[model samples]
Target: MNPNPLKILVLYYSQHGGTQNLARQIARGIESVAGCEAVLRTVPKVSAVCEAVESDIPAAGAPYCSAEDLKTCAALALGSPTRFGNMAAAMKYFLDGTVAQWLGGELIGKPATVFTSAGSLHGGQESTLLTMMLPLLHHGMIISGVPFSEAALGQTRSGGTPYGASHMAGAEGRPELSSHEQQTAFAQGRRLAELAVKLAV
Candidate 1:
């Protein structure tokens, strides 16, 4: 690892692992760039009851994201499983709590990207991705998406979109990604990292 590599934070909320799978592919793409490192973090589940409390650390998967992660990262990639044509409440909850970072301009000008997974092909993946970008835009982040130049964008029959990388997990909420979905995700990550490197310079 480069001692002072550029850090690209990959933050997400996954209910059935589909979004998490997409996040891993994006992280791989980010790490492919020299002097760039991917930091994977996740938001804890939100409960309907206000009294419900989650453990400090998750039982599995990436650890919870911290304010320091937002402050220090050179770039960001956010993902979430789709819910009613929007991002999961857990992710929305996490972003809602970042008012301090917004006030401090912590993420301003950083390159950012969004991704999502839905149970059906038309199950609001694009809408979910768009909803995830709202907070990033409020923070003054530069958002990137999968360009049509990526061959997978044209080839994907299931989940690839110009809005961002996405996956169709079917009703079962499977985690496995289609080949095109993976390719588009990797391309999106690499693009974000490359942009971050250039902007950092």
Candidate 2:
């Protein structure tokens, strides 16, 4: 491993904080590995009206992500709350701006993963994870998913998938992560970090 610590970017857009909870767990997993650090970031909500604007700094939670962050990360863990079976507009907007990174091949060989939260068990959790992976794929990132060997993947009745970590927030939109979901997120993050470290080596 390199002397300098690897930076794993944990980026997400969360409306009700469920996705944010997942992000934290993933970060924890990344940090569990030596010589790896997790950089947590979030995107601002988009306004339909062109005239609307948001403050540069978020009022709470993570700060907005920068293109430089994406360019420099050793690995990425992307997340979002499912929006009609897809990733939310805020995350899409942030990713759309990464064309410059794509052109530069800044992320070409980096490992990447995805996660999501939804309102129900059958909600678009998996679909949202897939859609989130599209941009990473375009950036030529090596995608990694949670494997079935993780105990949570096979046992979680809530929200665990081979695609990535997820949460079933139910109708009330709770932010608390279930134990199984937490383990799944940690496992995904650890896997991503481990892959990144090996690739960096």
Candidate 3:
């Protein structure tokens, strides 16, 4: 193993665990690349109520993402559950808070990718992935998508898109990913990591 591996941040927001599952698979793919590491982090839920606040640390699952994580990561894999064809408020909120990073070019030239999960097959998975890319674009990060070269992208009937990795969670919000969805997500992550490695050199 390399003495210092490149860190790929897998940041996500999941309400019912579906998005989180996809994030985990993507992380697995990132780790498959030698001299690369996947750093999984999550954002807390947001609420309309002004007084609502999450504890400094989460009760379970990945810890809340920190600005330090963003600064140190060599690459990024962003994920969120579909919310009205867009990213969930929590993920959006987190991204919105990164103006400091954007202005300072903390993410400039870094490779990034997106993933999402949606209820129903037509639940706007692609739109969510695209919307998630907008912030990274503004940050000057190199965005990537799942290319057709990945067989699972062409074969997935449930969830998989050229925009990025995705999953059809069904109306009940199941977190289990189908074989194709898993493969596509893995391919996406591996591709992003490879790009980051090359870019770093």
Number of clashes recorded per candidate: 0, 0, 0
Model 2: how far is 13 from its true place, Å? Answer: 0.5
Model 3, range 42-119, lDDT digits (tens) per residue? 998887762276688889999999999999999999999999999999888889999999989999999999999999
What is the model-wide C-alpha lDDT for candidate 1?
0.93
Which clashing pairs does model 3 show? none
* Model 2 root mean square deviation, Cα atoms: 1.6
Off by over 4 Å in 3: 48-51
User: Which stretches of model 2 miss by more than 4 angstroms?
Assistant: 1-3, 49-51
Candidate 2 lDDT by residue in tens digits, 73-155:
99999999999999999889889888889899999999999999999999999999988898899899999999999998889
Candidate 1 C-alpha lDDT tens digits along 98-142: 999999999999999999999999999888888888889999999
TM-score quality measure for candidate 3? 0.97
- TM-score per model over all chains: 0.97, 0.96, 0.97
Model 1 residue 159 CA deviation (Å) reads: 0.7
lDDT values of the candidates? Answer: 0.93, 0.93, 0.93
Q: Tally clashes: model 3.
A: 0
Candidate 1 residue pairs in backbone clash: none
The residue ranges of model 1 lying beyond 4 angstroms of the native Cα positions read: none
